[model samples]
Target chain A: MELAIGIILGCCALGAGICMGIGAIGPGIGEGNAVSKACEAIGRQPESKSAVTSTMIMGCAISETTGIYSLVVAILLIFVAPGLMVNILKEAINLL
Target chain B: MNRNKRLFKLVDILYISMIILPIMIAMVIKILTTPLSQGISISGARIFFSIPFPVQDLIITEAQLNSAFVLISILGVCLFLTHGINSGNLTTRHHIAEWIVEKVQGLVDGNMGEFFKGYAPFVTAILGLSGFSSLLSLCGLFPPTSDINIVAGWAILVFILITYYKLKGGFLNYLKGFTEPIFVMAPLNVLGEIATPVSMAFRHYGNVLSGMVIAVLISSALQGLSSMVLSWLPGFLGEIPFLQIGIPAVLSVYFDVFSGCMQAYIFAMLTMLNISGAFPQEEYEMRKKKKLLKIKNK
Candidate 1:
């Protein structure tokens, strides 16, 4: 019983770590590309800084939504699924 | 000059405190109530009251219903207070409100063109409700947008409008759009259309809910860390939550102010873009006709 619980937990921890680690790379590159281009645009036309910045932030926020989705999945894996796992184990034991 | 700068800084601090004070009250309520309701054991857990009413007793629970009630009441109060705008002398409040209305109208006009400029009020209302509901979390009230059902309902409304405009362009064309590029892509196009609203609701709901969760975790960690550090001191003084005083407020700025406002803007911008995208050829023809008529008149 102890071994099974430990393995379940270890898998969850591994899944959450993988979810966040892999998820972050896409948005990080997207945001860096966006901000670099935005900076160039602002430097070329200083008066259009506000417009450029707002557009840049909007695009970046959309890109970051995928990262946020992965974070939600990681959070659920870390905090919520473990509680459910214990319940499932209890149900299994009762069946026996 | 130095004195002026100091005075400005003081005012900024005062304004931030006014914002933070309400959030602090909300945090206290959440900390006291959330854990006990979730069956987590902690000191003073029994004293917590679950703000949400029981769900099983009624057709719909009062939790989300109350949040919507709160939002509508706030909108009602603002409309009542501004009811004087049409009557007589232009008050400063009326002037500012009208200015905002004009700006929203200009935004819609620029993006969606003159034909759809009439939707400025609709756009403003969506933005106002979204932004206000998100901000309401700071006042210790449950934000309506946190409810997926509530946000999904909003998305459905936008979806209906998008469908209506698309059909208006031509029902035949709308049907033809699904099979474009190849016939196998029709199912994918249909799925893409459905994904729009699902994505919007999920994005907004997820951001706000995560922000709330993170704030709770950080504040609790701060309390524990402070208690451990202060253990070297004697008596109940060591148990006091010294770190909780002003630390969480810094994090709340990003979670509440920045994220709240940005999500609101993004939701509204996406709504406008999608709605306008539905009327592309219609708007182009309208503009081209006006230009040709102008040249003929000259």
Candidate 2:
């Protein structure tokens, strides 16, 4: 029982860490690419600076949604999944 | 002149006291109620009370209370800005109000075109409420936006508006829009449509909640570190979380201020974009033309 509980907790922690660490890379790269392109656009045509900037910000925010979704999942895994699994394991052990 | 000056001073004092007294009372109550043994703990919005019903009991949370306060304060600010408006001899408040209205109108016009000019107030209200609600965390209150239900409600409203505009073409047309280009894409389109509100709600809630979680973690870490490092100091001095003094403020500046305002702006922008994009432009133009012809005939 103790080993099972420990395994559940360790797996949850590992999963959450992996989830956030891997999840952040895509948005980071995507936002960097967007900002760089926006910078290039502004440099080429300074007249449309405000328009490009707002569009870039909006695009970046929308792209970040995927990263935020991963974060929510990771948070749930860390804070909620462990206790829930432990409780279920305990109940199963008692029934056995 | 002396009497008038004294009266003005009295009025100022009264105004200041009206603002400060409630805050002071609340602070005292909080200080008294918080247990000393806990040291510091971070959690979800505290439930103040619950009302019994036939089904589930309705619970009032700190988020609802803070959001209500934010709304009332926004109302007060609007009233103050719009008070005694006129064409001539405009006050600074009047100018501020005009500037805000113009900016919101320009944003709606630029993004959604002139057809959505009337939605400036709705956009402004969302921006104000979301921004203000998130910023309430700066004052050590539970930010309502950190609550999923609040943001979900807002996102669902925006989704409803989008759907309403889409249905304006015709319910049959709206249903047919799902199977555009190919029949197999219907499920994908429907999934995408449902994902809109879910993504919006989760995006805003997760950002704010993540910032708050980081803040709490950092503060608690600082507390632990301070006690560990400063354990050799005198009584109570060592117990004080000296390391927590200015670091959390810097984090709050980004998380509470910048992120809060940015999320609010993004939410409002997405709402405008989604709603306006759902509208059929050719139909709108046709309606406008028909109206013009009817007026000419009359």
CA lDDT, every prediction?
A: 0.76, 0.87
TM-score of predicted chain B, candidate 2: 0.86
Query: For every model shown, what is its TM-score relative to the native structure?
Result: 0.79, 0.89
Candidate 1 regions exceeding 4 Å error are A83-96, B1-63, B280-298
For B33-59, candidate 1 gives per-residue lDDT tens digits of 564545312111122224445763323
* Candidate 1 lDDT for residue B157: 93
Least accurate 10 contiguous residues by lDDT in model 1 chain B: B40-49
Question: Using alpha carbons, what is the TM-score of model 2?
Answer: 0.89
lDDT of 1 by residue, A1-96 (tens): 888899889999999999989999999999999999999999999999988998999999899888878877887898778879988998999999
Error of 2 at B199 (Å): 1.1
Best by DockQ: 2
Q: Distance from true position, residue A67, model 1, in Å?
A: 0.9
Tell me, per candidate, how large a share of the native contacts it keeps: 0.56, 0.94
